[model samples]
Target: MKVRALAGVALLTTMTLTGSPATAGAPTTAAPAHPTAPQQATGLRAVADRAGLRIGTAVDMNALADDAPYRAAVAREFSTVTAENVMKWESTEPQRGVHDWAAADRLIDFARANRQKVRGHTLVWHNQNPAWVNERDLTPAQLRAVLRQHIIDEVTHFKGRVWHWDVVNEVFNDDGTWRDTIWLRNLGQGYVADAFRWAHQADPQAKLFLNDYNNEGVSAKSDAYYALVKQLKAAGVPVHGYGVQGHLAVQYGVPGDTLTNLRRFERLGLQTAFTEVDVRMPLPADPIKVQAQAQGFTALLQACLLADRCVSYTLWGFTDRYSWVPGVFDGEGSATPLDENLTPKPAYAALRDTLAIAAR
Candidate 1:
């Protein structure tokens, strides 16, 4: 019995170290499979199936069209997909009244082919509004009409295709106050409920969500959402989900109370999702940072797993090759489960192992 136990311990250690650091931009060989980590061969979507969780990743349209490997990885790895930019207001309607659904349509079709559900990113956001939408030229009444029309038209176009619509995005600040935007400046706080109503009217079946970052834990931001959900539910608003953008940095440790925060919203009769998760670290990554990043990714996944109503956990992007972090954040990058060469990092192993254990 002692010898058998020692053999099992040796096997576990080998599997754990299999995904350890390799030379930058070079593919690291996949770890040898074991009973607990089946995802190396089965892919995340397969393991996630047993657990009834929607494993997803944000899809970059340009990369999807241009890179064969990227396209394959997206189809094989995720059971749900969100357009990284194509579904946003500016991309969908760059020129006033001239909507371009080519890119967005292609994405939807891809998701359909892969049997993946689509998450319509946002119907309303202060940033990424088209050039024609503004307070400088249009009156408040005109702005309100335009906002309503935008929500209705967009939702109507994608009606049955979208699984969830982020009806409003980043409407609150860190301190739990409303952020100033064209919608707020012209329409007032009631615009939120109005947006939800407009979306529900267009697609009564699609779930509507309020999405934001920095609300993974019970902070002032989440408190504002909690209050808003209660008010919306009280008034019979169509809000159905709470979206936590799980963007974590190694410098700032993962929140310990994420599961607690998720449960509070779940109790309100709303499905919850980690909509945009990625764990970034400083450049010139080392073994310590790699391990820490894995923990950060699994931390969010574990919370979603434990919460009864947490339906999905989606990565912002799954590969460092096309990650948005380095372009946006000056000094930090490597914010994905896979390296630039499409090698699975330790984070990938961690997520797979967590899902495997949960399945059992």
Candidate 2:
């Protein structure tokens, strides 16, 4: 655990109690420029001590095959991890007849070896699914069987290792109504309840959450999610929390409204999380704009700290080098609190300061 405490490697040799420092052998050796060992980053524990925040990173398993910079960055930058894409249904189970866990297995392995917490991405969503899962081709009865089997097999596969599962993702539309996805269209409302129940049956200990992209702020979308959760809980479903994906833009609704919705979710006896937090900003960011972005992170963290049920806060990506914003948004932007070079931006410091302040 103490091997990679810094960028360079250091060796420890035990000595007899009566031995003096003069008895030690050569302590100097050529070391790697970047820290690839865990013991090296323990040296960064000083920085973390002063920062007082649960810094984390999102790991893309495919990147682990290459992407040295990313690998070194995550190994050195954060102690906690979230699977960047491995846990997605399309990645974990690309074919109906097969469940490929090679990618997800890497994430689970990394988490276990590091003793780190993992936030399992999604079980059900409108996107990131194979075309075969589309209900347009299947009869109602057939679709129900497919959905049931998918949930059961996938959940059972990663039962104890995955601490949290986004059991149902993007279940609601932006207007606060249920989506018209294959699951909803085929199985009706019972499908949503059944997903959570099936996940519980497969892994009774996994914390389940409903995740969405935009509902960061209190609006029609958020209120709709709230009402749906209330209905689910009333029916005694296994729904545990709401994941308000924090992908705030400078132009959208008031950012504080996200916190308002979070607090409201907590009131309903459910946990809350800033599931996919990323404050996007136009490139060549202005000082004021960057501060606003940082403030957004602080606001989200503040909501979590204040809400009794709120537990985890995760950045969409630790660095701007690999965010999904560029693919989804037309214009180029940086969505992460950390700079592309992996340096802590003002937003990062603000996040640290926010947590420190919260701790007090």
Candidate 3:
């Protein structure tokens, strides 16, 4: 997924908490420290266990495999896990009719070992699709058939294991227009409905969601989703959830109407989630920037907690060690709660404080 700042956004951007002692390869100038060991009573998962919500983070499979501290933090902090990339179409099916489930299976197994639920990210999206699924090469009928099969097969393979499937992702652009991707160009907007139905058929027990960024607050994009959800409901489509990819930046500030937006969706009989959350700032961090970042992280979380049926709050990645932000957005990093050395930041503290209060 590409990272681009929202247009006409001011660059600027919360929480309190303690930190664990820095480990090997720690940055020379560390973030202000918090007492993480004493705060173990309020580990994100521990507090979230009582808050009636699942706290999750996207897992970088390689880090889970090779980085001990990273692996440990993932298991300790989150109640659920989302694959950062491995479960996407390109990674899962590199070639036509050839599927690779090893990496995804490993994540599922890890989640099970830790008694965490797996959130199956993205059965359908414009990005990270396999190279073979060419727009110019396949006709609409052929494309539709392939997409249906992919959803069914992928969902079926993980049926009882996955708690939620982002069945269709980023189908609409920031302005509420259908993104001119292969699915929309070929199968039309009905592809969203078809993807959800196919996923439901494959895993009747799994919750299905439509996910997108820049739609966190009520706007043209969310309005479009509201209308689509209504239409799908009227037509008896099996869409179950609306996902707000809470990918905020300090410069953009947090959306003020997030709760209002979420409430409207809940009233429509759908669950809501703050998926893919991370608040990045301009590099060379300072006190003000980090403080704003914490607020950005907590604002979305507060909306989820306040909403009647917002089921989960998931960090795009829990630690900066494997963050996709720096690479994608030059001069911007430290998007996750933990820093690169796996030390907790103020953002981590803020989340802990928020969840701790909810737990109480």
Q: Pick by lDDT: which candidate is best?
A: 1
Pull out the clashing pairs in model 3. 11-251, 12-250, 12-251, 13-292, 14-291, 14-295, 18-34, 18-35, 19-34
lDDT digits (tens) for residues 183-253 of candidate 2? 77778888888889888899989889988867766777778888888999999999888887777764442
Judge candidate 1 at residue 30 and give its lDDT.
25
Summarize candidate 3's per-residue lDDT along 130-209 as a digit string, tens digits.
Answer: 88898678888999999998998899899899999999888776778888988888888888988988999999999999
Write down the TM-score for model 1. Answer: 0.89
Positional deviation of residue 226's Cα in model 3 after best superposition, in angstroms: 0.5
Ranking by TM-score: 3, 1, 2
Candidate 1: stretches off by over 4 Å:
1-41
Q: What is the lDDT of residue 221 in candidate 2?
A: 71
Q: Which sections of candidate 3 miss by over 4 Å?
A: 1-40
Error of 3 at 183 (Å): 0.8
Q: Ranking by lDDT, best first?
A: 1, 3, 2
lDDT of 1: 0.81
